[model samples]
Target: MLSAQHINKSFSGVQVLHDVHFSLLAGEVHALLGENGAGKSTLLKTLFGMYRPDSGTLSVAGTPVVLGSPKDAQAQGIAMIHQELALIPELSVAQNVLLGNEGRELLNYGRMQARVRPFLEQVGLNVHPATPVKRLTIAQQQMVEIARAVARQARIIIMDEPTSSLTTHEIGQLYRVVRDLTARGVGIIYVSHHFDEIEELADRVTVLRDGRYIGTVRQRDVTQDQLVTMMVGRELVAQTAPPERTPGAVRLDVRGLSSNVFREVSLQVRAGEVVTLAGLIGAGRTEVLRAIYGADPSTGGEVRLEGVLMSRRTPADMMGRGVGFIAEDRRHQGIVPDARVSVNMMLTSWAKGKVGVGERDMLRAVEPQIQQLGIRPANPHQIIRRLSGGNQQKVILGRWLSAGCDLLLIDEPTRGIDVASKADIYALIDDLARSGVAVLMVSSELPEVLRLSDRILVMREGRLAGELARADASEERILALATGVHTHAKDPAVA
Candidate 1:
């Protein structure tokens, strides 16, 4: 249905794509595989008319086409769902689905609901059409986006990280939707970080690295290890976290925590201890973190730091009390995407009055840490957004290090990062622990939690279900607790 030949594109002085050739046929689900910053997004944007390639020839359905704008792409029956969702917060689900194509003389609430209810049901979404998009979960919002594409009768759809925030159950639903779309001969180009999902859904896979096509392979003919090798061009190493540090007295304590999203949660982390919260999506791990950090209001709870009671627990209050948080959605909540590295690194230090520190001074301060943490390029003034996803995460870690946080709460530290960078981050966290800092981590990767945490706490239905010490924590133990599987097993330390 779509083909491109000899595509060339560039950003500023950097050439991102060169002589790239690609094609997608009707009824085929093509998997676009690459490490972050391999120009996958750029290539998708080129196909969707968001960027005009410096040089390329494009065709759809055997006709030469010049996609000048998003409308042009849509006119040709192509649609894209971005990595970051693009739903309006104030709009209802039905309105957001029908946006730009609502053809009515007057707004008909009932009519709109009737028109969209079937489509919503087709995607297995139980959400009411009149509910505001802001109130929906990330997975629900993605479903709405897919429904909108179906409403538009798009023949070719491109989805970027659609399952990043989805639970395993939601992913099964989405896979069904993809199957339904393909059964009707709609072509799909899927971009994702989860290789297992790609293996389950794709027929053919194309690999890209460093802005060039490496090769394409049939899904059935290649192993996961082979694909990783193609994408990275090197052996991927999973480094063991450093030696565990002896934990000191309790540095952070939360008792009887009650929030709208979570309730009756109690936990604590001592100095130098790394406690990981493990659970599936919607298990309320992020809500508990926010409540403890004072970013979200809790109806009933008490936070104590080293026997000192805290009267107020706002973000400012937490920061003053030496608590730092690195949120999960780094793009939306963590960093200033457009700012220079030095600027982002200096943000938490703003209260200390360093307005964009000089390159020499910033480097002088962060240079050794950057090297130790393996931050690529080691430049403090480079625009942060231009860096790869892993490097951006490292930059965020550098921020906390530069600011000297006493207790750190990190959420999904390696969600989409590369393996090498993941090792670096693990080492950085261990180094922090050695310095007498407490680390509370939240992750969806069971093996990661098992490997790095001194103890693992599993959440089920928004409550702490079980806790396992490092020596006793295993994949089976964590998974059983997370999925509510009953087994004759116990973490002796917790018992």
Candidate 2:
């Protein structure tokens, strides 16, 4: 239903998409795979009328067409579901679904709810249509967005990172929804950084690298390793080796931690050790880490670093205690978006009365890290907002390391980043552990927990369920602990 030929797009004298061609046959789910800044979003915008390409043509149903805006594309039976959902929080599900197409212009919610109920049921969303959207979870809100697109009767739907925030069960529901849509002859363009999702849902996969089309392959014809090579154009060096540890005295010690959201939790991370907290979403992993760092006020807890007791205080106080935190939501709590990379990188150093370091020293320190992390543009003066998600994360991690932090409290260190960038972050963390920086991290991806952790602490329902050594950990053991499943076989790989 949608196809593009030789599309070329540019912004501010830089080409982002060149000689790119894509197609979405009716009743097919096409997967678009790329690392950060590979031009996947650019192609979607060009097809959705948000950008007018400098060259090439887009067609609908074999007819060439030019779209001036999203409305123009919508009128031609195309809809896009963005990663950040656009539902109005104050409105009900029915109201958000029929926002512009309220039929009689009189804003009758009862009639709207009745009209929206079928679409909700069609997408397997069982919530009442009258329910306010803000009351739902992230996964529920995403399903509501999908229902909205289905209500538009669009022949082509573009889903960008739809499963990024979803849990395993919610992702399964989304997969079922996608299958239902494809069964109805709806063409879908699925853009994501997940390889497993593509393997499960994509009928065909197209790879992009550095704004150029690499190639397309059928799902059954390509291995996961091959797909990684195509997307990055290099053999991925395995960076998952566990870090060597020469752990000394305990650097971070927490005891009887209690929050309104989390129960009593006690843990210790020693110097030169990388310890990770692994659990499913909403398991209070982020809460415990935030409490230790003083970002969240804990109802009760005793924390110490290097044998000095810590007080219930602010983030700056924690920093003064030789602790640094890398928040999960980097866009808000981490960086100054309007500032330059050099400024953001040196923010912590300046805040700590280390202003004697000149601009040359700051840039010199960041220059090697920039090269190591593969941050694009490699320009210290570039605005933080101009970098991709993965590159921005590298800068944030660089900020804390440059501050000379002794202990790091990190949450979801690589969330929403691409695979190649994930490798860079993993290696950096592994290096930190080797350099005697105690690291306590929370990650939802099991592979990460297995790859980096000297010890994996499993949290379930806000309590410590179990702990596994690096030599004994596996995906099954972690899942069993996270879900409260009893198993005599905690480490089958130990033998």
Best by TM-score: 2
Query: Roughly what TM-score does model 1 have, to 2 decimal places?
Result: 0.90
Cα lDDT for residue 7, candidate 2 = 91
Clashing pairs in model 1, backbone N/Cα/C closer than 3 A: none
Per-prediction TM-score, please? 0.90, 0.93
lDDT per residue (tens digit) for residues 1-495 in model 2: 888889998765668898998999999999998887788878888889998899999999999999889888988899999876889999888888887777873367777888899999999999998899999999989888888888899899999989877899999999999999999999999988888888899999999888899998998899999999998999898765664578888998899999988888999999989999998898899999989988888998798878888875678888998898999887788889988888888889888966446878778877876777687757787788666778889999888877788999888998878889898889889888888899999999888888889999989888888888888788888888899876677454221
Off by over 4 Å in 2: 353-365, 488-495
Model 1 over residues 18-102: C-alpha lDDT tens digits? 8887888899889998876677878998999998999989999999899999989999999998878989989999999888877
Weakest lDDT window of 10 consecutive positions for candidate 2: 486-495
Candidate 2, pairs of clashing residues: none
Best by lDDT: 2
TM value for model 2: 0.93
Stretches of model 1 off by over 4 angstroms after superposition: 239-243, 353-360, 363-382, 488-495
